[model samples]
Target: MKNIIINFSVMIALLASCSPATEKKVDKKADSTEVKVNAIPAPSPENNTVLKSYIPVDLSTLVPIDVLNTKSTDVYEKYGIEFSGNCYSCDLASLSITKDTMIWTNVCDENDTFKIDDFSYSTEGSKTIVKTSERTYIITQIDKAPIYELVVEGKKLELNNKRVSRYFTTKKALSLFKEHDCGDFEG
Candidate 1:
């Protein structure tokens, strides 16, 4: 009986020494060897389209303002446009230049003419700038199309030409088909 009690007591003490304590302790400093997660952002719809590079060229390098103003010039033209969404209307807009006049016509046959001398002309790098009392116009010639940047007060708006060459020569040499539905607007 004495031997049995002694062995049992020894076994209990060994187990008690080997077992973990019930108390819990938290460290004040954060662990350095923690697992980190890096999140990647989702791709946007606008990022999927191919982007075109634009390099501005000097205005005078393409055509001198003197020659352009000497004759009636078609500054810009846009036609055969179909609006998106609920707007199912087709519209057109045009800008024409003459010796001492500038004319613009838009939807609903609204037209406006202004005198050339009413605006001051200057060139900044590749842009030909024309400034009025309240508005500023930046014109850049690109290939057949010219881009127009209009600045009023502090707001800026941009517009581009749709058609540069509207005359087509038939293969049969029948006649030169001219695009006149847009009117006598020419550049």
Candidate 2:
């Protein structure tokens, strides 16, 4: 009989020590918000189907930017875009140059136009200078790669342009040149 009582007491104690996973309490005051969570949120769907690559290109695959940017030359290149969560049509960019005229096109739209015909360009060290009637385009390249910067009237233009084509070198510098003015990735 004593053993049964002791066991009963122990059982009661063990039950008391356990805690409920969730508890409910009512707020006496009106307009009170109480939120209690017990489990993690369900997984959401994946949005971006695109993936990115960081591996550098083979040097043997690259051509000089001066050659690609030359007026008599026609250049076309594509860039594997970095998958930065959300991706629009601008995920990939295409650039083409014909007779001192450059056009930037993506999967979504027609193209953006840039005129080198109105401007005379000179290669100085790591920079390309295009002289326009109203603006002087100072294009600085990075690491001999095709990544270029077009600073016109002394302003850094944003060309969400893809990486350089030298890495591929045409697409990048050209895209950078395209975006140097305005318009979003899709724009």
Candidate 3:
């Protein structure tokens, strides 16, 4: 019995030692804050570097000011929702939705402005529709993101909540639209 126990212990020790070792290679680059692990490098925890990337803002985090209905006002609170690509035929539109007003601006006539009223909200199939005299917007949820589709003058442009920069006032939104290039809208 003693011999059998000794043999089993020896086998267990041998098996434990025979396991493959994980290769941990840490490469530190000069003049850089990030450390390289294997080939994919990530921000080091020690440096506390913030990774700059585009993250979609949640609509539930909006101030929740009830301008129209709960559904319409929800969409209205999002700031700086714009089309993601280049459209040469039509001016790129950036929209900022406030508690009381909806501000829409394009590349051309950055100085000029117009106020849209006569707002109406409805639902068609899976889409929630908001319309003004100037344009029509269809709101729908695709995956986890709410998609805002603007239909104006027979041209359709899609804006997503992913580009929303911050929950800002109407003045800040208007200033950003006027100061920045049409394609250069950050929010």
TM-score of each: 0.29, 0.32, 0.28
Tens digits of lDDT, candidate 3, 1-187: 9999999999998877665322122222321334233324333432232221111232112210111232433343332322332123233334544323444444333443333455655544444455666556554433222333333433343332222221222232232322222365544
RMSD of 1: 17.0
Candidate 2: tens digits of C-alpha lDDT, residues 1-187: 9999999999987776653312222332221432222122322212111111111222112222322233432233222233331144343333443335433344234453232355444554565555556656554555343544434574433345432222224433434432221235442
TM-score, model 3 to reference: 0.28
lDDT of 1 by residue, 43-123 (tens): 332332211112232221221111112243443222111222002221233344432334443322343222234655554
lDDT of each: 0.33, 0.38, 0.36
Better candidate number, 1 or 3, judged by TM-score: 1
Worst 10 residues of 1 by lDDT: 59-68
Q: Which stretches of candidate 2 lie over 4 Å from their true place?
A: 1-86, 89-99, 104-107, 110-116, 154-169, 172-187
Which structure among the candidates has the greatest TM-score? 2
lDDT of 1: 0.33
Candidate 2 vs candidate 3: the lDDT winner is 2
Ranking by lDDT: 2, 3, 1
Error of 2 at 71 (Å): 36
